[model samples]
Target: MKADAFPYRAPWWLPGGNAQTLWAALASRRHFGPAPRWQRSRWNTPDGDFVDVDQALHPSAPDAPLLVLFHGLEGSSASQYAVAFADFAAAHGLAYAVPHFRGCSGELNHAPRAYHSGDFAEIDWILRRFASEHPGRPLLAVGVSLGGNALMRWAGELGDAAAQQVRAIASVCSPLDLAAGGHAIGRGFNRLVYTRMFMRSMVPKALKKLEQHPGLFDREALLGARDLYEFDNLFTAPLHGFRDTADYWSRASAKPVLHRIRVPALALNARNDPFVPANSLPTAQDAGTHVTLWQPAQGGHVGFPVSHGPFGLPGHVRAMPEAVGHWLLTHL
Candidate 1:
């Protein structure tokens, strides 16, 4: 109903903001259920390039709720959150599908265009397409980080005219203010560690993409980008038709439009999220009537860690799934 602390507590063991942020991404904890079976499918965009989808079908309910998930930057079906949530949905008798960003599905996308934080076109297409294919099933969406930003932008852009077929929306650890997020990740050790981690995977892809459109981008200057802003400036903005990085972050951010969302959308951000500062988050008044902003005190970037059972079996990994499952139980 309003922006509030989402009944989640960070365990004492997961000290510091960055620790919570990195633990889930780095921890090798095993999932505690039968593995989900996925069908790999491709959706050809209006353009020639195609995006990929990994669908986790519901075992017994064809008309069950369908959860369409979008992963964060450089994330695909293999992302921890994606796999966890897909398993959660499937086990709950819900069908789930994960749509990979333009080039993240282990394949280079068509040229002159790539995925960005504000790419609502593809998300809109996914929602509409799923609703058409399923006919009467309820629809929901969950986006993490970059995907979260894109989901919020799409819902806000749609406003009251937003698709009624879509019943609810949830965004986890998204940087609604793209500029703020960019600033956060650009400074200090975050810049040193996170930026490099992103670029390690990103640079090679850009290099590979450049092979398709040789001489289109600066051969050396583009290759020398040291941070997210530089990367966006050299590649994302120009390739996707933005004026520059600043313009791209400004126009692509979802904060300014949060008030326009018409559906019961939830924005979950860890106040201590390493990538998005607490000040950048919205309050209930700022988010308008349609959106709920949940600011948990200590979830790192995409990490929401709770205590483990006496045996420390699943650890805090279950926190996110529990929260999401509870929210959906009430919302649906």
Candidate 2:
């Protein structure tokens, strides 16, 4: 069967109903293996602050086009998807770097401000710095999940400006409609599991931020928040200058910005992606002329496992990075 022919149709209840099973599988797939080697560095932001970055280079190809990778919420370069994608890029003689969002590089950010889905200024800073250092090399951007949303938003806002520097862009499993995604994730047992798991990581970060910046956030609100919406309402919204969670979600979702993208780009989504509903996808007609939407059937969220040959292939996963790398190599 052709790779694109794998069943992409999904049921309406899929995003909300199968949350636990799907997320559990994703967590297992992401955590089961040892991380690949990467060198850590610090990039000084324009604000006189610093952000940590992890770079995996193709030792033999230092002058190759650089691929800037962005991981999902609460994920860093250590994420399995990030590492695997880096490996694939390196194999293709591409140099890749994954920047750790504030507080995500195993070190807490110094300020109360944390990373958000629509924060493009930091990315702009990174790109400008890269351009200055590399001078002539092309730059490509690739992101997964939350990072995907950020990249799309930035591309949309940049419009024609992105064409001057970005050779190509690719995003996988990005939630184009954050409000819809939050609503979907809040239903039934999914709400309990996803909220619990995410909060386990987020609440600690919030608490640490509170300690660093006294009176910065509502401690009681952070502790009592039950879902991502509530958590963002109390924490992310105020810190980012948004009026509320709804406002933040509305501004952050990438659907409104897809048409503005003017560079060669690819958006891939699994029909059965547990975090994003299929209906929430940015309409194909709405995409820019340079954009390609690759919808594959079986990959659940980031799960693209395929069985090979007669013996039932176990413990194997076909991730999105392979397709992304192939497309980048062909187009860029």
What lDDT score belongs to each candidate, Candidate 1 first?
0.83, 0.74
Model 2 C-alpha RMSD vs. true structure (Å) is 3.9
lDDT, candidate 1, equals 0.83
Candidate 2 per-residue lDDT, tens place, 1-332, comes to 01352343322333432542353245333322344568889887766567998877446355688888888889888776786677676667777789888889998877668999888777777777777777666788888888888888888889999877688888888887888888877777657776688889999989999999899988987898988989999999889889999999999888788888888778887766667888887667767576788776546666554433355334234345766877776666
Model 1, which residues run further than 4 Å from truth? 28-30, 309-314
Pairs clashing within candidate 2 = 7-297, 8-297
Residue range with the least summed lDDT across 10 consecutive positions in model 1: 28-37
lDDT of 2: 0.74
Query: Which candidate number maximizes lDDT?
Result: 1
Weakest 10 consecutive residues of candidate 2 by summed lDDT? 1-10
lDDT of 1 by residue, 260-292 (tens): 998878889988888998998887777998887
